[model samples]
Target: MRQTWRWFGPADLASIDDVVQAGAEGIVTALHHIPNGTVWSPKEIAKRQQLVRVRKDGSPSGIEWDVIESLPVSEDIKKQKGAWRELIANYKESLRNVAAAGLEMVCYNFMPVLDWTRTDLRWGLPNGGSCMRFDINDFAAFEIHILKRPGALEAFTPAVVEEAARRFAALDDAGQKQLARNVTMGLPGSTESMTLEDVRAHLAEYGNISADRLRQHFIDFLSEIVPVAEEVGVRLGCHPDDPPFPLLGLPRIMSTASDYQAILDAVDSPANGMTLCSGSLGARPDNDLPAMMRQFGPKVHFLHLRNVKRDSDAISGSFFEAEHLGGDTDMVALIAAILTEEARRKREGRADWEIPMRPDHGQDILDDLTRRAQPGYPTIGRLKGLAELRGIMTALGHREFGLQ
Candidate 1:
């Protein structure tokens, strides 16, 4: 595996120097300054490449941009309405530009409205550390009271609904506002700034959309974009839905192993692949992480290796971020499965045998608490995760006979 780190642009709290000091070999980032549904010009791509490679004093940073965390698929593309064709053309042109710039892998998601959601960004852990969490009742409170979306009550059980009502009754005005902000903060520049009116209008547009309709839209999206990806020799990976469940009356199509297999089989191309985020998929207890990796390893183009400790046995139970090797998923077996895939690719003489991976999220501990970094992306925390994952990769490579 080639180690990588996700970096927001120049204004990010975690600097490029921090990435280098942490021992990452590659960068996983996007052109976030550009608007969604716009084409990425080669000039813009080159400018980002220069930023990643060159230091402030014109010295070398000694790392290259390896994978695009996303080239976003627009809302118009997801619903297949309102100038979707133009957005599709723009997406294809972006892929062409990415390839022309010598980058090969791109990651994107098909989740509607929100990129991800969590009720609490500062869930306190027992060890006095802090991590992100998704408490079911807290989310229900947001739906029933904060956003006040119609038909939201029908999605949960009677017990959950009653609990949500109680929770919502306890919140003061400031608490209610903070909860709304936390849920909408998933996409950095996109929905993070949406007002209550903006959120209500956004959910109303999807009233007529169902799981079947949204899925077909995703297939229609792939049928058009995957061909261009194959032609340009770029690999496109679809990230799974975070929390792996339906929320805010929205349909979730990529929450399970079956969901992924269905999409891969529908498109039937190497360019159509999976991002293989362990933390997101692990949110569902039914998803056997190692087994899924073994079955779908050939189609996985990129990796986000983190862990989550679920609060209950139920698939939709609350969960909080865990240490790299401390969560419900089997880190040892998962790494072994990935090595098996890499060995097979090497035997077939494939160029991209070593899949790029990053330590996805980490718990806030030590100096991280005071740094006040991005919610899940503290400097010291991720360094700890990368160190643990690197140790596992090294041990696995040395123990396996054919692994290098």
Candidate 2:
């Protein structure tokens, strides 16, 4: 595994120099300033490449953009409506531009309406730290009272719905508004922000889109884009749905191993690959992270290595971000499996044997608590995570494979 760090452009609180000081050899980023369905021009790609490589004072950071954390998939393409066809064409052209710039991997997600959801951006932990959390009751409160989405009551279990009512009633106007903002916040610095009305309208658009239908749309998307990715020698990785389950009565098609396997079979190309987000998949108890990695080893193009502490045995129950080695995932076993896959790729003479992985999310600890970094992305927290993961990789490399 090649250790990488996610940088949200120059506006990111974590600077490129900060990434270097954290010991990351590669940077994962995207051209977020560009609107969705628009082309990422070669000039813009080069500009970003220069930004990643050169620091503010014209000194080399000695790091290049290794992989695009995402090349945003437009809502039009996900719905297969409006200007979806044109968006797909634009996506293909963006792939060409990225590949032409020498970037080989691009990660994107197909989750509709929201990219990821959390009820609390600063949920407290036992150790006096804070992390992002998804409380089912709070989420239900949002669904029932805040957004007031139809059929919200029937979506959750009886206990959850009842608890949600209590929680909703306890909140004042300010509390309710905060919860709504937390639920609706899209990726930081993107144009996907939504109002209550916007969310309802989006839900209305998906009224006829079932899981099967959405899955087909994803397949149609891959069928059109994967070949172009292959031609450009770029790999396209589909990030798993966060929380990996249905939310607000919307369909979740890419949340399970079987779902990913179906996707692998759909386009059946090297360019069509999995992002293998351990945190997202690990939220579900049924998802065995090590086994999934071993099975999907060949198709994994990138990795988001984070861990989550689920509140219950239920797959869609609440979960909070845990320390790198402290969550439900067995980080050692997963890293070993990744090493094994890399060895296999090397033996087969694959040029892209090293998978680019970044420490996905971390709890706000120490200075991070006051720094007010991006919600899930705190400087000291992620640096700690990256160091721990690197230690594990180093130990496993020497112990399991005897590679120094």
Candidate 3:
């Protein structure tokens, strides 16, 4: 596996120098400054390439941009409404531009409204580190009280609804505001500045859109673009729905193995692959991470190797990011599964045998807390995770030589 890092461009707290020092061999970033539904000009792409290849002192950084973390699937494209056709054209052009610049493995998601949601950004741990968390009761409270979306109560179970009501009743205005801020923070990465009204409006639009309808829109998107991906020699990987569940009564189409199966069946091309995110998929107890890897390994073009500890056995419950090997998912088994896939690809003479992986979100520890880093991305924490994963891969690689 090729270890990589996700950098949010120049404004990111984690600098390009940090990536090099952390031992990441590649950069996973995008033209975040570029607005959605616009073509990425080759000039802009080249500028980013140059920035990634050199340090501020003009010395080599020993890494270049490898994968585009995303190329933003616009809301227009997701709903197949408004100027969707124009946006899709822009996307195709962007695809061509990136491929022409010698980059492959583009990642995107089809989640409507919010690409991801979390109720708490700085949940305290017993170890004194802070990590992001999604408590089900708090989330339900947001739906029933903060955003106050129509029909929000019916979306959750009766027990959850009751718990949400109790939780909402306990909060004063200040707590309520903080809860709202945490949920809406997902807007930044989704690239939309939506107020509560804007969120209401977006939810209303999807109110009439069913799960099947949203899924067809996703498939409709791939049918048009996957051919272009194949022609451009780039693999387009759709990231799974974060948390892997429905939120705000919005339809979630990419939450399970079956969802991915349908997607692969619809497009049925090597270019149409999965960005296997273990954290998101592992949030659900039903999703066997290693099994899914073995099943979809051939079509998985990207990897987000992180772990989470769910509070309950239920699919839609609270969970938090855990240490790389300390979560519900078995890190050893998962890495071994990933190696099996690489071995198979090597035997088949596939050029993309070594998959690109990045240590996903990490807890805030030591200087990480004072660094004011991106919510889920912290320097020391993620480096710790990468080190652990690297250790596992190394041991697994040398197992035949008695290293195991």
Q: Which prediction has the highest lDDT against the true structure? A: 2
For each candidate, give its TM-score against the true structure. Answer: 0.97, 0.98, 0.97
What is the per-residue lDDT of model 2 for residues 1-404, given as tens digits with 9 covering 90 to 100? Answer: 99999888988888888888888999999888887789999999999899999776789999999999789888888888898999999999999999999999999999999988888999998999999999999999999988888898899999999999999999999999999999999875564688999889888888857899999999999999999999999998999998799987989999999999999998899999999999999999999999999999999999999999999999779999999999999999999999989989999999999999999989999999999988999999999999999998989888556532
Q: Which of the two, 1 or 2, has more lDDT?
A: 2
Report the lDDT of model 2 for residue 314.
93
**Candidate 2 to native Cα RMSD, angstroms:** 1.2
Report, for every candidate in turn, its global Cα lDDT versus the true structure: 0.89, 0.91, 0.89
Q: In terms of TM-score, how similar is model 3 to the real structure? A: 0.97
Off by over 4 Å in 3: 187-191, 399-404
Instruction: Return the lDDT, model 1, position 376.
Output: 88
Task: Find the 10 residues in a row with the least total lDDT in model 3.
Answer: 186-195
| lDDT (Cα, 0-100) at 195 in candidate 2 | 91
Question: Positional deviation of 127 in candidate 3, in angstroms?
Answer: 0.9
Q: lDDT rank, highest first?
A: 2, 3, 1
